[model samples]
Target: MRIFDVAEITRNIKEMCIEANYSLTEDMVSVIREAAKNEESPLGRRILNQLDENMKIAGEDQVPICQDTGMAVIFMDIGQEVHWEGGFLEDAIQEGVRQGYQEGFLRKSVVGDPFGRVNTGDNTPAVIHYQIVPGDSVRITVAPKGFGSENMSRIFMLKPADGVEGVKNAVISAVKDAGPNACPPVVVGVGIGGTFEKCALLAKRALTRPVDQRSGIASIRELEQELLEKINRTGIGPGGLGGTTTALAVNIETYPTHIAGLPVAVNMCCHVNRHAVRVL
Candidate 1:
């Protein structure tokens, strides 16, 4: 067994929080750049160009790409053979978020209470998910989810009879209704066939996958491509000005479900689908 220092987790998370806010992954950047070129509408193409320029400036200036710095969502895959030391792991993670937001000058958008609506002061208590695996190394993924697109996400509990066609319609309808509000030129993360909450989590996790990457499962890959094509055809376009570049990608994840139920969740993310990944 190997000893792991929880302090390292804290240090990495702090840097990751700052990194994710300042820039997007190369795959995401490349896709957006390509979209700008192929965009059929002048306005859409112009909006994409502005987005590209914004990304460039954010990196150079060390500023967040979006005003909403977002609530931190962290996913961790921990190794079973590892032992943690140096303090409570949970506290360390929260401290990392607090420090990152304060030091990096990223906006603190997390509220302490749902209804009372007071700011959390330092963006503490991130939404964290943990998983155990066989390896000795830990993998961390930080996704800063902006509410502009998050608020438009949806979950549909379709009867098993609804099948594949219904799944497609549910996703399409969500995108149609979201329109500009979801920050068109979106990345759609879809979860199909699981319990209600599980599907939502799956959908959220799907966003962490590279936009250009498709599911390894052949059928799911086809569905992803088809959904992406249909979503782009919706004419939502970049910045919702109406064009052919509505969505950048559609990523889907699936798990086995109950015989009687088919739960589907659609998690919407803006063009700035921000996430940073690291391993230790």
Candidate 2:
């Protein structure tokens, strides 16, 4: 078994927090560019261009792309053969977020409590998810999800007979309801099947995927394409100013579910789509 240092993990998470906030991923950038190219609305094309410029400026200036730095959400794929040393893994991750947000001068958006509503101060206690996989290496992805789009996300438990059409309608309805509130040119992550919580997680995970990549499953891939087309037809456009580029991409992730229940969750992400990764 390979032993890994917790300090190393913390250091990487710190960098990821800063970098993800300051830069937009290439995949997201490419999607925005293409969206701009195909956008029929003059205002939509302009908004997309401005968005690209904002990202470029953020990277060049080493500043956040948006004012809302967002809550730190991390996903870890830990190899069963790997052992962590130096300290508690969760603590290390939280420490990293605290340092990154503090040092980078990022906005501290996380609250200490759900109802009491007090600031976490340093965005500590990051939301982290782990999956055990086969190798000795560990892969961590830090995705800073903003609330504007996240709040617009929806989930539905449909009857098995509701089927594909139900999912399609739900997605369209969610996007339509979201409208300008989600900031438009959003990324839609649909999680089908699984339990309620699992489906929600799958949706969040889906947003971390590369915008241009499709599922390996042919049926799922086709559905993603179909959803993207239909979502764009909503004419939410960039900044919800009205255009054909309502969504930059539609990603779907599915899992086995109970025979009687069809659970679906949608996670919305704004144009920024900030995430970073490290592997060791």
Q: What does candidate 2's lDDT look like per residue over 1-280, in tens digits?
A: 9999999998999999999999888899898888889999999999999998988899788889999989999999999999989999999999999999999989999888899889979987789999999989999999998999989999999999999999999999999999999888999999999999999999999999999899989999999999999998877888999999999889999999998999999999899888998888
Stretches off by above 4 angstroms in model 2 are none
Q: Model 2 scores what on Cα lDDT?
A: 0.92
Query: Top model by TM-score, which number?
Result: 1
Off by over 4 Å in 1: none
For 54-117, candidate 1 gives per-residue lDDT tens digits of 9999988887999888999999899998899999888988889999999999999988999999
Clashing pairs in 2: none
lDDT against the true structure, each candidate: 0.94, 0.92
Best candidate, lDDT-wise?
1
Question: Would you estimate the TM-scores of all the predictions?
Answer: 0.99, 0.98
